[model samples]
Every structure is written in C-alpha cells, then in structure tokens.
Target: MNNYYQVSASYDDVGNILSITRRGLVPDANCFTPQEIDRMTLVYDTPSNRLLRVGDLAPTPYRPYGFKPGVSPSAEYVHDNNGNLTFDPHKGLMMQYNFLNLPTSIGAMSLTYDATGRKWKKDGEFGEVEYDNGVEYRDGVLEAIYAPDGRLVAEYPSGGNRSEGDISRFVAEYWHQDHLGNTRLAFADFNEDSFIEIKDNPSTGENELEITQESHYYPFGMGHMGHGMLLLLQRIGTCSMVLKEMKTWG
Candidate 1:
C-alpha cells in the first residue's frame, strides 16, 4: 500500500493563520522502517499574505532554516547614463565584492555577447576602455580576445589556448572522484609545448608544481583565496608528489 499523506489547515490567531499535524504509518513485515513525522507550524500577516511566526503545539517562533524573514543589508547599484547595469568598485556582484578583488590589481571587465549583436553585461574596466572599430568577429564569435590595452592575448582556437567545448575532452572521469583519488587536474600543453602547467590536489585543497622529464618546474600560480600552496603531483605511468603535508601531533 502506498503510505503517504499530508495534513494541513488554517486557524485565526493574533491576525494570522496556524497549521498543525501528526502523521505516521504502521510498518509491515516487508517494510519495517518507521514512518516519518513532522508537526507544529504557523502563519502570520494573513491579510498581507505572509507567515510571520509558527509554533510548537500549533506553531510558535517560526525560524527559517538559512535565514529568518527580514530585510538584509541595503546595497546600491551602478548604471550608465543609458541605464545599462554597470559594476561599482564597491559592490561587485551579489551586492558584495568577491574574495579575489585585490586593490593592487587593476580591475578588469568581461563582456559577454549573445547570439545577437546586442551588448549584454559590461563589467569592471571594460567600461573604461573604448571599443576599437577594428575588433573582429566571425560567425557570432569574437575572433580576437584582447587585453585592456588592445594587445592580442590570444586569437581563436589556433592562436590562444582556449577550449570552448566540454572539459571532459581533457579530464578523465571529470566528475566522478572528487576526493582522494588518482585523478588530478593538470594544464595540458596539448602538443607538449612549454606554455604553463598547473596541478592541484582536491583532497588537501593544495596546488603543486608539475615537473617535466627535463626537470623543468612550472610554478603554480595561486589566485586569491587559494586554500593552500600544497599540490598533488602525478605523472601517468609514473609516481606523484605532494606539496605541504600535514602531520598529526596527538
């Protein structure tokens, strides 16, 4: 028998509505697990359509799991004269600055273009740099990825190293083992070209330098808020190394 049911109703109390319940089912030989039970609730500000406080027997002291109902800290937004959403140096996204925001580093902006020619979000220093007329695009794709000063950091698939497809093309079992496993992250040179190499240990949250047969040590660049400098180093058909190891005292 499909044993599943919910009980709910409303009552008036101090200009609000209250709900109560008690539910369970007798177990059988095939299914011996005890039935779940949940009770006590309340609703307030009925006229305005709101649940202010719930209780015990009926519903008392309503407490939202993550947060109670209330107005959060106020935040201001920035917009250009055309009313386009702009990034404020103070408030980045979600009404707060990300941990990566550094005072020394010049704030950079990233603009995303949809299929249409319409300008979407213009963030950070992108607002500062005037768009050059020579910027190229092909088949709705930006042909040139440039720096703030208009220098070509990378071209399309052939020039700069930017893979736009599913990352599974590079990583094996990308999503499966995220814990202490043999699978680690490394920046593939693709053609064995000496560009930049990076590797990290998911278990220790540490990033380690991956070395080559020629004994070339590629430094691991740690962005802001990196957990630890430790790294998980591994070479296929070979051994691996760890950065900083933590030892237990007691």
Candidate 2:
C-alpha cells in the first residue's frame, strides 16, 4: 500500500504526512469528496514518478441506481508496478469507465496516454460487446478491435470503421498518429448523422470511429474535471437519442 498525500501536502521518506489531509475541508479541501473530486484536476505519475495521465474523476449523481446524488462508491484507482494511482480502473484517464463499469445508457473516456506511450487501445470484440482492447497513442488516440468470445472478429479505427480492411489495415491506417502534435478529436457524420465518433481510447481525435453496429449512435460530451466531476450535460440527451435510433435502425 503506497502512501498518497494531497497535492498541496508534503511527506517524508519515513512515511509521515507532513501536511493536512486534503479531505479535511470537505466542499473545499476535500478534493476527493463527492463534489470536489468531480471537478478538480487529476495527475497520475508512473513508478518512476513521471506524470502518466492528467484528467478528472467526474460525479455520478443522475444514475438511476448507485450514489443518490454524489460520487458513486464504485470508484477505484489503477496502478503500475509501483502502485501509484496513475489511472482509475473504473474511470480511465479521460474518466471513461471500462466495459464492466460503464453505465447501461452512458459512456466514458476508456483510454489515455502519457508523453509518448500507447496508453489504451481497442482490441476488438464480438457480438454487442464481448471484449474490445487494443493500442493507444501518447496524445490519447486509441485503436481497438472487438471479438465476441476470443477471435479477432471486428475492428474500430481512430477515424472510422474499415469494414473492407483486416486487422493489419486497421493498424496501418488508424493506429499510426502524425507527428504534427497531439491529435484533436473531431465528430464524424458517417451516415450524415450528427454523432460524435468514439475511438476505443480516451482522448478524442479525428478519423475515429464507433463500433457495436449502427445500433449505437454517438453521445456527446462525456469527460471529467480535475478531481472526478463528470461533465455529462449533453450526454444524457445524445445517448438516449442514439439508443432509440439504433433500436429503430435495427
């Protein structure tokens, strides 16, 4: 169990909290509190103490179930070999939940990256959503494939779906990032629909695509503030519309 002190607090090698707990001042100092964690800055460091991911945790108040009106009790942190809370298993770098933790009618940034590492990627999955995992870029761009049980059956690129290409083609066209700079996220109207493309990774990017079929349309604006406050303002409406459209489209 590694020690985690408040950003403003100090510590000693002997394991002494030289500063007060960040939670001492709920609604103010309690950055991890239900409200604050939902709207504070987050920075994760690697085992070498280098910054890994910077993002938020987001609040989960509107859920039909779970925390009535505050942060949910299901939140958790992810650690490398050093056990540093560099990532949130429930809420990855961009604050997106993983396959197991995602809400039925919601979404989260399921990918993230550091200086120049493949933080997360979509490996692909099978029917509906068996398992989708793959590789990612430093700027948070993701490239994941999906498979129902285990075989590589489907693929989702950063830009869009390449129904004509195989796994290698998916990697060549969508996986590689330009040296221009961090990839900025862009919405695509594949079928002239106003849906935000969802890459398997967390950070948004151009040319990204959504998987799972036309059944799932795009939901808008699902990210986190510094601490953990989830900014899901437009998400509810968009997600609802997408799901409804998918039901009819199918």
Candidate 3:
C-alpha cells in the first residue's frame, strides 16, 4: 500500500498563505486517522504585502545597523529604503547590496559583479568560484561547465592542483527534471562501466541507485532532508540566477 500525506493551506484575501498544515498517516496503524506532521503560520505586512513573520514569532519593527539594544533580541526581518531585504534572522547577518540591489556581501561571503550587473565571482569560506561564460572555476580550478539550458553537463575532479589532462578528470553528468523544471536526479558514470549500477543501501535497508546526486523539493522549492545525497555542485550564485530568471519569467 502506498502511504500519502495531505497538505492544506489557508490563504488571505490577497492570496498570501496564512497557514499551512500537513497531515499524514499514523505509523503501525491500519485505521485511517490523519496525524498532523507539520504546521506553520505566516504573518505579513498587509500594506506592502511583505512576509514579516513565520510560525508563532511576533512581528518586530525593522532595526538599522548600530541600533540600541532593547529588552530582548528577537528574530526580525529588516529591509532597506528601496525595499531590498538587508537582514534575515535565519542568516544572522546584515547583507550588503550594491547600487543595483544585487547582494555584495553576506556574512563571510563576498560577491562581485561585472559591468552589466552579472555576478562573476563569489569568494566564501568554503572556496571561491569564478563564473566565466557558462563555466565555473572553483579556486582557480575548472569545476563544472553548464549548458545553455542551465543543465550541468560536465564536472572536473576535485582539488585545485589537478590538471585538465589528468586521467581522473572530466565526469559527464545527466539531470532528470520534473514537469516544473526542478532537478530531481543527477547520474554519472564514475567507474566507466557500460551500465549505471544499483546497490543495496545499508543505512535505509533499501536498494539505491548509484548516482551522483538526487533531490526532492517541496512545492515552494525547499529541499527535503535525508532523502538523497548531498548536491556538491549547488551554489549560491546558481540559486540567485535561478531565482532571478524565475522572477523574470513568472
């Protein structure tokens, strides 16, 4: 029998989601008793239609940098005069933006854009990525090359010391996307075998595909935890580009 979950949402007059409730089947029970798995309440600025709070958190006024401390420090969303989000409590830092409203820095990571406002470089604690054309270089090493359709076609071996002609270099990857163009699976021939392999996963006690990575997302693009391997190629620059494209085409 297939188990299923039901998600219901309550929306305001302007179509803003006020609350979302997820109900699922009770474990080890034959009877159909819906058990609540998750619930979230969203609060918004009515006039501006901006999301102010999520869950049971109270909406607090925006605070600028160097503001005096009050009785308590609560999670608050801060926006600049141009309505650009400058701070998010979840990130725990004030984001700096350029004149074009493009984010320049967030915490330890810093970004640089070209003359046309296209992001060309990202330097962070993990590593640095330089975007040139459709290719990405990580710390002065060829990391990956993307297709015009935004599909990652190839990736090079890790480590900055490896050369382009190295025997362990250049792995081809294929992506399988859903109807909404969400990437669901990424597979590659790592062993150079003629066939893609499948093996038993000891952790989950299930047969798993030996693929590079796989991901499942919620309706709003939030990824599900513990469902697949870590996506090594996912980066903030790519996410920002995708979001910008979505906003433009939506």
Q: What ordering of candidates by TM-score runs from best to worst?
A: 3, 1, 2
Model 1 lDDT tens row, 1-250: 4333234446775534465453333234543322323254554443544444434342223222111222321233343333333433222432222232312122354454444443444446423222334443333334444333222322334454444441123211111222333223323343334644444457775444342112111121111111132233322224534334457553
Worst 10 residues of 1 by lDDT: 215-224
- Per residue, candidate 2 scores C-alpha lDDT tens digits across 1-250 of 2111122434445444333212111232434333222222333343344333332333333231111222433444544443334454334333233334431222332333333442333222321222224422222332344232212223445476444452333321222122432222222234335554555544745445643222111021222223223235444756743433446665
Residue-by-residue lDDT tens digits, candidate 3, 97-170:
99988999987899999768998999999799899987888887667887733344444345634545642556
Clash totals, every prediction: 9, 38, 0
Quantify all predictions' global Cα lDDT against the true fold.
0.34, 0.32, 0.62
Among all windows of 10 consecutive residues in model 2, the one with the lowest summed lDDT is: 214-223
TM-score of predicted structure 2:
0.21
Best by TM-score: 3
Number of clashing pairs, model 2? 38
What residue runs in model 2 are displaced by over 4 Å at the alpha carbon? Answer: 1-37, 41-78, 83-89, 92-122, 126-180, 185-250
